[model samples]
Target: MSQPLTGVKVLDFSTLLPGPLCSLLLAEAGAEVIKFERPGQGDEMRSYEPKVDDDSANFVLLNRGKLSVAIDLKSPEALSQLLPLIREADVLIEQFRPGVMDRLGLGYAALAEVNPRLVYCSITGFGQHGPRASEAAHDLNYVAASGMLSLTAGNDGAPVLPPALIADIAGGTYPAMINILLALRQRDQTGRGVHLDVAMADNLFTFQYWGLGNGALGDWPAPASGLVTGGTPRYQVYRTADGAFLAAAPLEDKFWDNFVALVGQDANALAKMSPHRAIEAVAAAIALHPVAYWEDRFAGQDVCTSRVVSLEEARHEPHFQARGLFDRSVTTAAGGTLPALPVPVDAAFRRPDRSAASPALGAHNQLLNR
Candidate 1:
């Protein structure tokens, strides 16, 4: 079957994580994603560490199956060269500050006049016309500004650094793709394109639904003191006897009963204890046994628990292997291939080619001449 975005055309002018990841999803969904990189240097991610060939694995992983057009957007003749592509493009994604694209004469207003049906998407730390629209910030700042960083705390009551770039991917890339798809759908009816203003910091509030609800009712959640946080014995990471961690979340009564019973505690009696006392009790019981013992105990039980595994261990997980999440491959310039980054895009919407490579800088520069 043909992919969902087979006929869509995308012009990606964003680099690094957010915009590139959005366009990567588009490319995987069969959109012809043509990435416009700066001449000579190309994307900054190409220079990042952990190299696969001459370029970083980060760049190739996010940009596979996409075309590249290297051009000097600062040149006087750049607008003329880009006009043809702009006129034929269905979507344009950029990550510059608010007025940067307008200064280059490539903003949504100018391009929409050329192709009225173009969906222009701008991804940034702050949306256009906001108080902090022009602020220079990264993923960490975005998460901190959105009140998400305050919710996670270490044992000493200090906030912990998030393991992943949540704001960049969850707040920026995912929202941009959703809004871009929405804009495309709207364009089919109105025959006119729209501009999408996606702010990474702004989009993060959606992830804190419970926090928002509680805050509005004059009861804000303290750090590590929420239901899904480390507030309850039912939802916590407990250390096993062998120094391994097991993430436990037997939240519901039924699951909690089964969990307490399996942990060799009286479920009814433990349920009556104070939250902290219950937590201490559970922790003590779990500390007597190793991770392997609990893993076997919880294997077929209704308890919602899992032993924490390293990234390397997760790669070899039986469930993920059965799901074929790592089946697709990405080829490097040196002809070495590795498992592709597993994305959330569905199989039916992805390209048929399982093995694909990222473009060399300006590899499709012939399109500029056309």
Candidate 2:
């Protein structure tokens, strides 16, 4: 089966999670992604912890199936070398702050002039023209600025750090991928490309649609008071006797009834209790059993209850293994194999072989001469 993006060419100039992850999705869908990195030092993510084959596991995981071309963009000869690649690329995605690309003379305007059908995407914290466009922020800051952090407050009323990079992946990567594909379709019709401004902070507002809708009405729910956020015992995490956590989200009445019966709680009492007391009641019941006990109790129960496994445990999960989620592996320079990180692309679109690995710095420097 031919992949959907088999003929598409992508030039990725982004670092860290958002842009690389976006390009990874594109690559998985069969785009020829060329990751442009700095001359000596590569993406900063290469230095992150939990190294594999002397490279950050994160870097290897996100950058597989992409070629690396190293160059000093600040040098006078940069444009002459890059223009050819830009001209051939169907898409160019970067994660620099506003005006940074313009300063380097690799801005969308310049690149688009050379390749009229290029879908130039710029991913930033705020946006190209926003008041905080130039502000420095990471995943946490972007989520905080988007009001998501306020909704994630713990019992002590302090915001808890999210377990995932929701802002980076959801805000930046997913939007960039969607918009770039949309732009490609548009280009097919008009024979002209578009410059996409993917603002991570701005995109996050959509995740609060329910809360925003409530605020627009006369009654505004306080942070952490929404039904999904912790306003009800049906949707919350409970600690097990073994100190592990169980994510209990039996929101529907049927599922909730099952959970109530299994935990030996009165359904009517739980349904009428204050949110605080309801949570306490669930917590108390859950604390009486170890995670393994609860796991056995809830197996095939349709109660929407599951153990909160660690990353290591998740890697070896039976369900995921049965689904063949980790069927592919990328080989390292030292001939070691690490599982290829899964992307959402359909199996028919994925590469049949997974020999593609994260490249060494300037590994494809010869491409510049060509």
The digit string of per-residue lDDT tens for model 2 on 174-284 reads 999999999999999999999999999999999989888988996565655788888889889899998999999999999999999999999888768888898899899
Local accuracy of candidate 1 as per-residue lDDT tens digits, 228-268: 87889999999999999999999999999899999999887
How many steric clashes between backbone atoms does each model show?
0, 0
TM-score of 1: 0.98
Off by over 4 Å in 1: none
The candidate that achieves the highest TM-score relative to the unseen native structure: 1
lDDT of 2 at 39: 72
Which residues of candidate 2, in runs, are more than 4 Å off?
none
If scored against the real structure, what TM-score would every candidate get? 0.98, 0.95
Worst 10 residues of 2 by lDDT: 329-338
lDDT of each: 0.93, 0.89
